[model samples]
Each structure stands twice: as structure tokens, then as C-alpha cells.
Target: MAGTEIFGIEEIKALTDVIERKMIHRYGSHSVRNGIYRVEEFEEKAKKITGSKHALALTNGTAALITALKGLGVGPGDEVITSPFTFIATIEAIVACGAVPVLGEIDETLGLDPVSAEKLITKKTKALVPVHMFGAAADLDPFMEISIIYGIPVVEDACEVVGGTYKGRYLGSIGKCGTWSFDPNKTLTVGEGGLILTDDEDLYFKMDCYHDHGHIHSKAHDRGEEGKFGLGVNYRLSELQGALGIVALDKMDATLEKIRKTKKRIINSVKDTGIKVRPMHDPEGDTASHLIFMLPSPEAAVNFSRAAGEAGTGFSIISQNTWHYAKHWKALEEMGEKDIFGTKAPSYAAETMAATEAMLSRAVMTGLNINMSDGEIERIIRSVKCGAKASL
Candidate 1:
């Protein structure tokens, strides 16, 4: 999961070039820029890789998400349906735009359940953010169908699976707009960066100016002379981050390849002991960041964790993971959106999504590493095998 594990001369060279140039700003310093624009280059590379007609680099993934949401005209009182099993940034982005964040139930893929999402949609539903959780595709077919029928745009959150694809299409490029994170934990780490990809020219231009003080960017005009589109925020990516990102794209393939192969090995080993591995919609397209097992019951999942510990490895149950699971999000409860918005804040109580909760409670998972050694893989395999024998 840590792309930093494979860092070498490429990353160093990128940083050195940025330091030597002394042009840390992304735009308008033409005199010292030396005809080098790493941020633009990074955006070009991102567009080519993701097949997006336009790509905009931003300060972080959260910023990208917010920009995309705002670009679609989501604002006060509007509803955006997303999965409860995603990073908190997804919810925060909606709130940042004064939109109501609606949490939908998840299906087997550990993403938004399409049926539940459709039921939640209304006239105020402006977007359907189907997060590609744990490096696997959500059941996007139904989500996309609902999007087309309801005329709501889908903002695919591919932050967790940077280089992953869905049915041969890149995850971020599949929806109306896709967003990605390039932080240290992602497949392509630039230390801290985010990207937005879209084919809609209007949306692209809107986000571009909105991320940079609402100045309409043009090569012919100087930075200060550019026309203002509207009020905007400084979610701009720096030249240093851009330089890091250019080289980071080159490292993504190797990281993803290693993750896919190693993840398959671990899953195969665990499945042989009759442990049910989480199903994949498009197995070949998965980034394989995580290998999940669905135990027969929550009690069995606890035993499985003990088995993993005994084998000198670690396993996590989402039911207990406060950071990612919505049910445990005390921070959300504390914020008390119910009073701020007209409708009640969406509930995260276990009973509200009983089936999804049951599934989460019976599940244990481990993240795959780009730097996992063969010995480490074997050690995890042995842990599952031995653990299953004692626990199951």
C-alpha cells in the first residue's frame, strides 16, 4: 500500500530538479521557470494514463473531491449519496460544499450498495459517489444505470485504488468525473497531492479556475491579468509536488503489479483452508491493496484475528475500525448535522444497515504491500492456514 517503499533515484532526481530550479510555484513565474512545468507535465501524464480528456492536479484528494462536487453544482440542501465504508475525506468534501452527506449501505464489494443508493436519491440528489473501496470495483453497473436513469452524475472516488481499472476502464475515468489521492499511502505517492479527471470541458475549466483563485489560466496573459471566473480557493498543487508526481506515475505500474500478484498469492493460500475470500467484480482490474476474508460469524472473525496474531501477522475487522467504518464515526455524530440541515443526519447505527453490519462484523482483512517479501507472504499464508485450523 505504501508506494514510498519502492522509492529510488527517480524520486530523488525529481526533487533535486525542483530544488535547483527554485520555481516552487506552479504558475506565472515564467522568468525563473526555465520552460519547465512539472505540474502541467504531471497533469498531461495523468490524462494519458486515465484516458481523461482533461486532468487537474490539486493540493490533496480531499480538495479534488470538493472541487468535483462543487463543479457539479452541489450546494446547500443538496444530497450526495456515498458509501459509509470510505475515508472520512469523502464525507468532509460534501460538507465543505454545504451539501448534505448521505451514507448508503455497502454490498459485498465493500462499497455503496446500488439498490440502497437509488432508494436514497431524490430531486435534491445531485451526485452518486460510488467509492472503489479496498482496490476493487464497486458494482458500478447498477450505479451507472441509476445515474443514467436519474440523471445524477457519479463521482467515482478512486483514491484507495490509484492504478486500478474497472472492466478495462481506469477507475477514475469511468464516471462523469473521477478523483484520486497521491499521498504517501497511495499507489502513486507525491507525499501529498490529488487529481481530478473529467471529459466535460465546462466542468474542467470550472474546477481549474476554482482551485486557483478563480483566475482563468491562459499562456498569453500574465497571472495577475487573467480574468476572474468567480470566487475560488487556493487548492493549487505546487511545482515540487508536480515534479514528484511526474516520477511517481512511472513507479505506479510496478507497485500495482507487485500488489496484484502478491495479493493473489495470499488469497489463494487463505482460500485453500476454506476461508471465503471477498469476491471481486473484475478480478484482473483490482489493485489488490487488500485481501479480505468473510468469516462465518463475528465470533469466528475474532478467532481469525487471534490466529493471525499467533502466526506473527495482523488482521483487522472493519466493525472495529473507527477510522473507515461509518458506524463508529463519533466525530460525525459530534458534528450534529441533523440541526444544521433540514433533514435528519443520516444514521450510521448498525441496525440501519443490518446486513452490511453483519458482513462487516464477520470480515477480517489485511492490506497488501508493494514491498512485501516472499518470506513475509509465506508467513501470512502460514498464519491463515494454522489459524483457520484452530479457529474454524
Candidate 2:
């Protein structure tokens, strides 16, 4: 919802200017290849913003995840532990890398439970991918400790929590490597783009090469020049997308501030509704992009959601959403005894996430967008109040 609409008129002008510059300079479509200025500029800005040593722009968030996994050497026989309550992209990335995805239980935070993740670890556990769902930071300290103890890398899926911070450190910067999405509904949008951020140079280079057909290019050996090629695929972001991303990134702070203020107001509005409502995770020291609350029970959640929808202020029931909910993933059902890697697939399905289900069954959520007018916010508050009263 944050990036659902155009935020500034300058962004359109910037996009047009970049397109004209590309055509005038005869750059063709070599956004990443010809060293188009905006691509590198966006990467540098991203690195600075995320406090990472290196950042790479890619095609989309899913590609970012796959590239991060490939860069970490997670494949075939390796097992990647992640939350079952996240978007399918989290598990799909592990599967794309030929790694067995071990679904871990979530705590009250609605993120991967560090205790459950520790229990899922084995000799084959190569990585832990924790999704920072709905702009809320997961319990990163324990995950960091687990990473140190097991020598396993942590790749954070911070697609929905770009500007959020845990404690003092940024969410994405806390892990070994992290990814952010710039889709239509993210904090920032370049239509369809993704970013990989890391402090590890070796891993960053690997991911860079992996996303760009394995060609390790330099100033001396530019696009057409001789360079060593490794195993990779095409995952480059276009020049137009890079330009849009630059503009979007520039406005990200203001946009997040507005959404956070509006979210606080909405939270305050529902405070005394005599309904049990609590945030899925602690919101202290974080920029919230969504308003997610847990109701008293599953029936209350359903009834509230229905009443809200009728009042024209619908809230998404996390467990019932096909995209974010884990139970609807058809790919997991297709996993047989053994994959192409000869490693047995982890016995993980919707039923395995007992805690996640129990939490989501009573959860009601709505996206917080900066584009929402004050009238819209007021209407949403009124609808929510009405829904709570009707359900009670």
C-alpha cells in the first residue's frame, strides 16, 4: 500500500528524462551492461540507506532471494529453514535454488520462532531465511546467535519491512544478507524491481555475478570486454526501473512517516473498542507499513472481517489469503519423497504450522498507505469501530 500510487510528480518527469537520456546516448537496453549511470547510482544509494557495504539491483524480489541463495552456495542437499506464515516467495526461493525448505513455527511475533528454527537445524542446514512480514522486525538477536553457533548464514526477506529497524540496527543489515522488493505494493516501487544488500564483499560479488550472467565486469573490462563467466542467469533491472527506484528511494522516508502517523491514529481510534486487539509484533522503534491486530478468537476475527467488509473497510484475514498464507502453496504439495538433488524433501505442509495457524486464525490486517487521505483514514476508523461493535 505504501507504493501503491504515485507519490510525486517529479518521479514521472525523472522517468521521462531517463528514457530520453538513454535514447540520446545510444545506450540501447544495456542498463546494467553499459554501466548506465542510474543503475549504479541507485545501488550506491541503496547501500548507503541500508548500511550495507554492497548492494545490487535486480529484476524482482524473487530473483533477489534466488540470487542470494545461490551466492551463499545453498543448493541440492542443503536445507533452508524459514517461516511458514510468509508469502510463497520465501519458500519458492529455497525451492528454486534446489534446497529443501524446512518450515519453522512462528512465535507471537508472527515471524520464525528462533527456538523452532534451532530445533529444525541439522547437519544439512545451510541457511536460515527469516521473513520480516508486514514491516515488523523478527527476533533477529536470537537468529544472529544461532547463525554464529551453527555457522549458518541468515538471509533476511525484508520485502515488507524496508525502513524498519530492530533495536538500533536496521532489519536487513542485521542478517548476513538481506533482500527488499520494489513491487507495486512495497515501501518503494520501481514497478518490478528488487535489491540485495550485504556487508560481505565475496557474497556480494557472487550475487552480482549470479544476477548478471556470471560476468564479473570492471572499469577496464566493461560489458563487451573479456571477463570470467560463472553459472548465472539474467536478472538485471532496466534503466527506467533504476531511475524510478532512485526517485522512490529519495521519497521513502517522508512516505513512511506519513503512513506511520496515520497508522498510529488508526490504532488509537480502535483502542477502546472493548475488543481484544494487539499487534502481531512489537512496533517499538520501527516504521509500520501495515496495521495488523489479533482478535480474541477465530470466530471473532471472521465476523469482524465480514462486518468490516460490509462497511467498506475490509481487512485481510492472514490465514485465508492465498498469497501470504502457507496452506495454499501448491508447490509444497508437489514435493515428492526425493527431489532432483537426491535429498529427501522436508515433511513440511500447512498442518505443520500449528502456531502460525493459531495466530493467523484470529488475525485481522490492513495495509497502510501514504496515499490514503484523511477522509479515507476516518472512514476506515469508523468502519473498524462498527465492525468491532457488530462482532461483539
Candidate 3:
């Protein structure tokens, strides 16, 4: 589930170049650094890939989200709607902004249900965030429609699907603002980094100043002397991470190609078993980092999971996976119970999220390896067949 699997001498070489120069800051070290700016270069590369006009690099994805929200002027007494089936970072970013996170139910795409989101909107709603789960996109057209209709900004959380696209456009590029993660577990690893993609120029500058210590960076003014935008935080990306990011971004096409092939092979092999592959808004543009299937019922999912485990090809039952799903988020649950999210004791109980609960409960998935051996693939295929048999 990581891009680190393919790290090699290129990563080492890039790091060595930065270390040998003794340049580790992303900004303002011109004399000794020979005018090199790896973080700027990295942002440029990201903008090119996603066709975004501006890209802001940060310390991690969570910071990117918080900054993007802040740039959008999200703050106290406001509510931001997003899917319940996302990393806790999404909610945390909203909370960090002194805003409330309103969860919308997920549809078959395992993403925020547009209708559900629209129904939850109030005058306080500031934004709509649609998370691209796993390696594929959520249904985005309706979310875009909702955004336009309600005059709400859509922030695409493409963290899990870094290289993935939707309708021939990159996932993050489709929204008013998009964000991606480069954690060690992501398809593009920069050790720990995050980025925001946007076409809005003013929004870009706002985030730029907000990520640093409020100084609007300039070549002439020097650090701390530049005019301040406002109060800010230190989510700056190190030049070291930036150097590694350049190499990681270069490998995205190859990584996506490899993972997509692995997923296609497994999906093709299991199609005859009456199991349903998870739906995607843009199948062709999927990163295909994971192979997920929908069983007829939750009981079948349990059986399938049991069989897969016994066969030594353990599948992730998404409902119980604390890292990705909201049902397991005790902190959020507690917060919601206190009516902190602008709703009265919001529920994570299965009955409350019947639609999302049913879909995630009946789903089982496994991550694909970019460097999977033929023998390993064969074993996985055999194990999937066993699970399918048990499911049916």
C-alpha cells in the first residue's frame, strides 16, 4: 500500500545531492544553495501532472487540508460536509478550523452520497468535501452540481488516490481545490509531505502565507521581513522531503500502470463468481492500488473474509478497518455525541448510516503490490477463488 516499495538509488542520490549541498530549507538560502529550490520544483511537477494552476507543498496531508480550509475562510460556526468513510484527518482539519464536520452517507462508490450531502446542508454549510476512496474516484458529477447549486466549494480529498483521475481530469483538479498526501503509505512517498492543487491565484497566495509563519515570501525582502498575511503555522515542507518528492512524482505513471495491471488481473479472475467489484466514477483512470469486491450481504462478506484469511490471503473488511472508516472513530463519535458537529448526537451506529453501513459492511478488499511476484499473484488468485466460493 505504499510507493516506498520501489524506492532505490534515485532516492538516495537525490537525498545525497541535498545533503552534500548542506541545503535543507525550502526557502531563502540562495548563496550556499546555488539558487536550487526543490520544493518549488516539486510543486511545479505536481501542477503539471494534475493540470492545476497552483500547488502548495506542506508538511503532511492533514496540514494541506487545514490550510485549504483556512484559505477558503472556513472557521467557527461554519459546517463542512464530507463523507463518513474517510481518514479522520478530514474531520480533524475542519475541527482545527473551529468548524463543524457534517458527515454524509456513502453510496455504492463508497464515497459521499450527493443526495445525502445536499440534504444535510444548512445556511452554515461552508463546503462540501468528496473523498476519493482507495484507488478510484467517488461519483463527482453530482457533488460538482451540488457545489454549484449551493454556492459551496468542493474540496477533493484525493489523498488515497494520488495518481488517479476522474473523467479524464485529475481527481484533485476537478474540485475548486484538491489535496493529496505523500505519506510513506501513499503511492507517492516523500517520507511525509502534502500538497494542495488549485487554479485560484489569490487562494494560492493565502495558503502559501498560511503554511509558513504568515510571511508572504519574497526574494528581495528576506525571511520575517516580508509583509505578513495574517497569523499562520509551521507546516513548511523541508528541502529534503522536496528532493525525494521530485523522484517520487516521476515514478507515478509507472506505479499506476503496475498497480492497475495487478488489480485488473485479480478482478477479471473473480468476475465469474457473482462477486461485484467496487464501482468507480472513472474506471479507466483508477490508480487500482486495491482490489475491492461487494458481497451479496454482510454475512457473505464475513464468510469471504474468513475463507481468505484461512487461505493466507487476508482481505480487509472495511467496516472494521479503523484507519479508513468512520464507524470505528471513537473520538469523532464522542464529539458528535456532544452535538459539536452542528447536529444533535450524530450517530455512527449501523442503523443511522444504513446505506453506507450496508455497502461497507458487505465489502472486502486487499491492497495490490507493485512488485508482486508471479508466485504471490497465483497464491492470491487461488485465495480469492476460495473466498468467492465461500461467499457464494
Report the C-alpha lDDT of model 1 over 1-392, residue by residue, as the tens digit: 47778789988888898888788888897765678999999999999888899999999999999999988888888989998888899999988888878888888768789998999988889999999988888988888899899999999998888888888889898889999999888877888999999999999999999999898998767798889999899999998999989888877787788878898888776776898888778888988888788888899999998988888888888788887887777777665446435555665555666767887998888877888889999998998887677667
Preferred candidate (lDDT higher): 2 or 3 = 3
lDDT score, candidate 1, position 361: 90
| Sliding window of 10 residues with minimal summed lDDT for model 1 | 335-344
Best by lDDT: 3
Candidate closer to the true structure by TM-score (higher is better), 1 or 2: 1
Cα lDDT computed for each candidate against the true fold: 0.86, 0.81, 0.88
List, in order, the clash count of every candidate structure: 0, 0, 0
* Superposed Cα RMSD, model 1: 1.5
What are the per-residue Cα lDDT tens digits for candidate 2 across 1-392?
45757556877787888776653221223554445567778888988887889889888999999999999999889999998878888888988998898888887777888999999999999999988887788888899999999999999998777778788667777799999889887878888999888999899889988887787857654477647558799898877888888898888778778878888888898889876655444576456776777778889888888888888888988888787877777767568355647788865566677788998888888777777888999988987888798777
Error of 2 at 303 (Å): 2.1
What shift in Å separates residue 229 of candidate 1 from its native position after superposition? 0.5
Q: What lDDT tens digits, residue by residue, belong to model 3 across residues 80-138? A: 99988999999899889988888889988798889999999999999999999888898
TM-score for every candidate vs. truth? 0.96, 0.93, 0.97
Model 3 TM-score (2 dp): 0.97
